[model samples]
Target chain A: MRAEPQSFDRVLSSMCTEPHPAAREAAERFLATNPGDPGTYPTVADLEDDAVSLLGEIAGLDEPAGYVASGGTEANVQAVRIARERAENGRPTVVLPESAHFSFQKAADLLDVELRVVPTTDDGRADLEAVRACVNEDTAAVVGVAGSTEYGRVDPIPELGEIADSVDALLHVDAAWGGFVLPFTDYEWHFGHAPVDTMAIDPHKMGQAAVPAGGLLARSSDLLDELAVETPYLESTSQATLTGTRSGAGVASAVAAIEELWPDGYRDQYVRSQNNAKWLASKLESRGYDVVEPALPLVAASVPTPLFEALRDEGWRLSRTGDGELRVVCMPHVTRDGLESFVADVDRLETRVGLEVAGASE
Target chain B: MRAEPQSFDRVLSSMCTEPHPAAREAAERFLATNPGDPGTYPTVADLEDDAVSLLGEIAGLDEPAGYVASGGTEANVQAVRIARERAENGRPTVVLPESAHFSFQKAADLLDVELRVVPTTDDGRADLEAVRACVNEDTAAVVGVAGSTEYGRVDPIPELGEIADSVDALLHVDAAWGGFVLPFTDYEWHFGHAPVDTMAIDPHKMGQAAVPAGGLLARSSDLLDELAVETPYLESTSQATLTGTRSGAGVASAVAAIEELWPDGYRDQYVRSQNNAKWLASKLESRGYDVVEPALPLVAASVPTPLFEALRDEGWRLSRTGDGELRVVCMPHVTRDGLESFVADVDRLETRVGLEVAGASE
Candidate 1:
C-alpha cells in the first residue's frame, strides 16, 4: 500500500535512473499544473515549448516542432500516426528494422498500418538492402534506430533516409536512448545529419529528467498539424498531443534537466558511462565471454543462463536479449564499482558451478 | 524557460485542483520510478494495483481490472479501443452524446471508427431515444457521460447500457470528473448500479491527486486483456497501458490521496462545493442571469459576452460553454470566499459596462 522507492544501486538493466536534482524540484513545483490547458497554466505550457526547443538542440534541429509526450511509446505511436495521416497511398505501410523497439508493433496495431520488419545485419545494424527491398509506394514511413534495445547499434540512417525519399515516405529516427549521448559522439543520426522527418527522444533516459519526459520532434510545424484535433474548451484552439490534460511536471522537469545539463554536463556524464561500459565489456571478455562492443554506453555479453540467474539472485537487476545475451545498460546511475561487483558475482558463480565454456561459441 | 507555477487562485473552470498534502509528498518520493517496468520497481508497481483497487471501491466494482493511465484521454481512448478489439462487427462505429468530451473525437479518428453523436435533452442529459436509435450491429461501443464537461449532467446510464446490450456493444462511462464525488450523491451510474463494462475516472480531477492520475477500470479482467500487447524485454510478458515508461508518481499520489480522503473527506468537500455552486447560481439568477441548476457542483450562467470578457479581464480565470454561458466548476480549491470574490468581479463588470439584462432571455 506504500510507494517508497529503493535506491538505484542494483538497477543495471533499467533505462530509467535517479532524476537530476533540478528535475525533481521542478516537477514538484509544477505537480498541480495541467499543460494540456495551456491558457490556464501558461508557465508550464511555455516550458513545454522550451523543452521542445532544448530537444531540438540535442537532436540537431534549429527550428524543431514537437511536444513533450507521456514517454517513448506515445512519441513513437504519434510519429506513426502522423505518417499514416499524411500518406497519399492507400493502406499506409511502414518499414522498420528488426532492431526497432516493440512500440512500433503497438503503433501498427493501433493505426492499422502494414508493418514491414526487415532483417538486421550480423553486426546488429539494419540491413539497408532489405530495407530498400521492403519499401514501396505504400510505405508511410521508414524507421532507423540510433540505439537498439538489445544491443547498442546505430542503423545507417542517411541511407534509410535516401530509401524513404525514393518512395516519397518519411524517415523517423528513434533516438529515445541515444539522443542525449549521440550529440557527444560522431553518430550520423538526428535531423542535422540527415533528412529525418521525425524523431523520438527521451529526456528521462540520458538527460536525467524525471519519467514521462519523452520528446517527438519534427522537421516543421506542418508535420504536427497533421495530428491536430480541435479542442473547443481549452486556451488553444487545437491540440496535437495524443493525451489530454497531461501533467506539466514532465514538461517543467524536462526543461530544468536540459538547462542544468545541456552540452557540458551531459558530455561529461556520457564519457563516464561509456568508460564504464568499456570496462565492463573488457572484464567480461577477459573471462572468456563474448561481449558486444560498447556502441553507446550499453554492453551485451553471452553469459550462461544459470550464471545470469545466479548473479540476479545476488540482487542485481538484469535483463536478457531475445537471443539470450545478458544485457547491461551503463546508465548515469551505474558506476565502475557496480560493474566490478557484478563481475565478481559472475566469477564466484562460475567457480561454484564449474560451468562449461558455452559463451565462447558466440 | 522558467516553469515556476502561478497559484490556482483565480482558476474556477478547470476540473483539476491542487494536490492533497499526502499526495504531493508521495509523488515527490516516487518521481523517478517507472510502474510500467514492474519487475524493476516492484513497490510502485504494487502501488498501482492498490490504486486500482481503491478506485474499484469508489466505482462500485467488486473485482476491478484496470491500470493507472496518463490521463483521462488515454483511458477513454483505450476504452474505445477495447470495444473495437472485442467487437465481432466490421467497420466499428461508436455512439456518443454531444456532451461527451472531445477525447472521443480524437479516439474515433485514431481508431478508424465512425462516431455518431446524438443530441441531449433539455436537462443536459443524453437523449435515451436518440442513443437507442443510433445503436446498430456496427456499433462497437456506446458512451455515456456521468459528468459532462460544459454542464455537469449525468446521463441515463442504465438505459444506455440496455441499448448497448441490444447491439452487443460495450458501455463506457466517462466519470473523469465525477467519480470522486458521485459516491456521495444518489446517481445510479456506476458498475454496481448498471452493467457498465468500462469506465474512465481520473484521480487528478476531483480526487485531489496530482496531474496524470487517470484511472480506467473494467468489470472483469477479460476486458483489459483485449488491449494487451506483448513486451519482449521486460519481466512482465504483456502490458495493457497506452504509454510505456510512465512516472510512478501518479500511481503513488492517487493511492495516497484516496487513502487520505476517501469517504469522510471527499463527502465533506463535495457538500461544501455543492453548497457553493448553489449559492453562486442563486446570486447570478438574482442579477437577472439565467443559471443552470447546480447539478453536480458545476454552474452555467447565460451571461453576456462583454460582461464575461470583463470578468476575465479583471483577473478571473473563466471559460464559457459552447452556447456562450459562463461556466464554473467547484474543485477542491474553490471556496465560498473565492465565489464571493468572483461575484464581486461580476457585479463590478456589469456596473462598469452598464449592461442590459441580456441573460434574462434564457
Candidate 2:
C-alpha cells in the first residue's frame, strides 16, 4: 500500500536502505514471543536493562543514563527540557547551528528556550567562532551537530567541547545522523569522550533499525537526574523518552542491529560507505555539478532550482537543502553499478533538460 | 534477548502478538522483493491519491486534509500546538483528568500551557462536573479520556462535548487505549462527530497493528491547517501528524491487521476480552480486592501496599497506579483460562506473601 511520506520514514530512507538484518530478526522474535506471565519477560526491569545496555554500547559510555523514545525529536525535546530546567539566569538559550535539524528549533519552541542560531560556513558546517561569541552565563546548553542535516557536514565537536568547557555549560550533540556511522568511521573524533554531556541517536537511520527507535546517551547521570520528573507511567528508574508503552519490535530491532554491527562489521560498513561517497562525489563533480567540500557519505550539490524538476522528470529523488542545494546520501545498499547508472541517468537528463551547468562559464 | 521495556517496544507489542502471522508474510514478501530505489517508489502524487481515496472511505469529506506522524503522542502534540495557535484569549489552559495519560501533561509542559488537573471520580472516570468547571475563557481545549491509563475508564464524552460547546473550546479525546475497542462496542458514541474536535488513536494498541502506528482524527480540517508547520523535511499538504519520513511497515502491518480483524473478528475479539476482564475482575473482587469503577475491558485492583510484593514473588508483573492501585488490561490474546490462572495465582500469592485480605481493617 502506497502512503504519504512521513518525516521519520523519509529520513530513515534518506539515510539508509534498511536496518541491519539482525534487528529485523529481533523484531520478528519479539513479535513471535509472548511477554510471559509477569516477571519473566517484558517487565519494567527487563526494559530498563535493555535500554541501559543498548545506550552503553551505542555511545560507548560507562553508564547509559537515559531512556529511549520514539525518535531523535523526543530525545532533543528531553534535552531541551533539561536545559530549560537548569537555566540559572534569564530565559534559557539553546545554542545550535543554523543548519541543524528542525527538531532543535522545535524543542526550543516547545520548551520556551530562546534558540540562538549560529550561522554555518558555506560548506554547511557549524561555525564554532560564532558559537563562542554567542555563549554567555545565560546559556543552558550548547548544541553541536555531529551531522548537519543540509549538507551532512559534521561540526567540530572538539571545538564545541572547548567552548562548552570555557562557558561551563552542557554540550548536547544532535548526532541523529552520525551516531551510528561515526563509531564505524576512522574519524579521530569522539562525542562521548569530549565535553558533550548528552547526545541523541536514531537506530532507524544509519543504525539500520526500525522506525521509532531512538535513545539518548548522556555523559553524566546527573544531567538526566536534573531533568527527571516522576509520573506513574514514566519513572526515574526508567528512561522513557516518550509517553506510553514503546514499540518492543523497534527496541528488539535496535538491539539486534547494534549486536550485529558493533566494533567491526558496522565500522567496516562505514568505511566502505565513505569510500563510496567519495567516489560518488567525484563522479558527480566530473559530470559538472557543484559539489560541496569535505564530502561525507552524504553529499550536497548546488544547482539551479529547475534541476530538481528535471531530475524528477528523469526519475531521480534528491532532497533539497535549506540553501537551495540538493542532497544525495550514499547508503550501504548503493552499489557501484547503481551509482554509475544514476550518474548516467543524470547526464542524459541534463542534456535533455538543457539546464546551465555550475561553473560552465569557464 | 529479554530487555527492559521501551515505549517503542510497548507500542510494537500492543499491535501484535508474538509471531504475528501477517508480519511473517509481510517480512517474507519484503525479503523476496527489492524495494528497488526509494525514489522509484511512486511519487508524491500517487501517495496523495491513495491518501485521498482512503480519507474518502473514512468520512467522505471534500478536500480531506491530514498528515502522517509516528504515533499518537506526536499527533496530540501537534493538536495541542494548533489549539494554542488558534486560542481565543489569555494564556492557554488545558483541562484533563489526573487519570488521563501523562502525554497531555507532557504536551502542556512543551507548549507552556497551564494545566488544570480536573478531578476524577473514585471509579477512575473523569468527573464531568469538575471538567465543566475547569473550562473557562482561558481554556483552549477540554481533554476527555477514552479508556484512561490508571483505571481504563472512558469518561462521559457527551457531557464533555456539551461543556466544550458552552465554553467555545475544542474537545480532544485521547483514545490511545480505547479507540480500537470503542468502535467495536455497541455504544452509540461518535468521537469524530460534531462538538468533539479531535481524537487520537494508536492503531498499535487495540488494533493489533505494529508499533509506531497512531492516528489523530479531527472533526474540523482547520485544526490540521492551524497546526501545520512548514519544515523542509515535511511539506504541509502531505502530513497529518508530525512531519517526517514514516515507516511503511507500520502502514503495512496496520492495513493487514485491519483487513484481518476489522469486520467481525475485531468485534468478537473485543467481546472475548471484555468477558475475560469481567471474569478476572469478579474473581479478584471475590478474593476481596477493591476494584476500580466504570468497568471497561481493563481493570485496576486497589491492592494493599504489601500485595505488590506478594504478586511479584509469585511471578506476576504489573504496574501500580498513582494512588496505589494495580492496573491490568485484558489484551486480545489473553485467554479466559489465562485470566483464571492469573487470578488464582494472585490470590495464592497474597496469603503466601503475608498480605492481609483486601478491605481488612488496617
Kindly list the per-residue Cα lDDT of model 2 for residues B1-362, writing each as its tens digit.
Answer: 44534322222112234323563444323321112123433433343333333432333234444443456666677767777877877488878888776667667766778889988886667888888778888888888887776667778787888888888888877776677677766442344443667767665667676554556666668877765444663212232334344555554555555656665766787788788778877887888888864356777778776766566555554666677777666777667766676777676777655645444655
Q: Per-residue lDDT of B1-362 in model 1, one digit per residue for the tens?
A: 45369888899878899999999999999898999998788889999999999999999998899999988899999999999898887789999999999999999878888899999999999999899888999999999999999999999899999999999999999999998989999998899988899999999999999888999999999999988888877878999988889879999999999999998999999999999999999999999999999889999999988898888777777878888799999998998999999999888879876644545444
Best prediction by TM-score: 1
Q: In model 1, which regions exceed 4 Å deviation?
A: A353-362, B1-3, B355-362
lDDT of 2 by residue, A105-168 (tens): 6676566689888998766777878998999988888888877666777778878888977877
TM-score of chain A of 2: 0.86
User: Which 10 residues in a row give candidate 1 chain B its minimum summed lDDT?
Assistant: B353-362
The CAPRI quality class of candidate 2 comes to acceptable
Worst 10 residues of 1 chain A by lDDT: A353-362
For candidate 1, the docking band is medium
Per-candidate count of clashing residue pairs (backbone under 3 Å): 0, 43
lDDT of 1 at A310: 81
Q: After superposition, how far is residue B51 of candidate 1 from its true place, in Å?
A: 0.8
Best by lDDT: 1
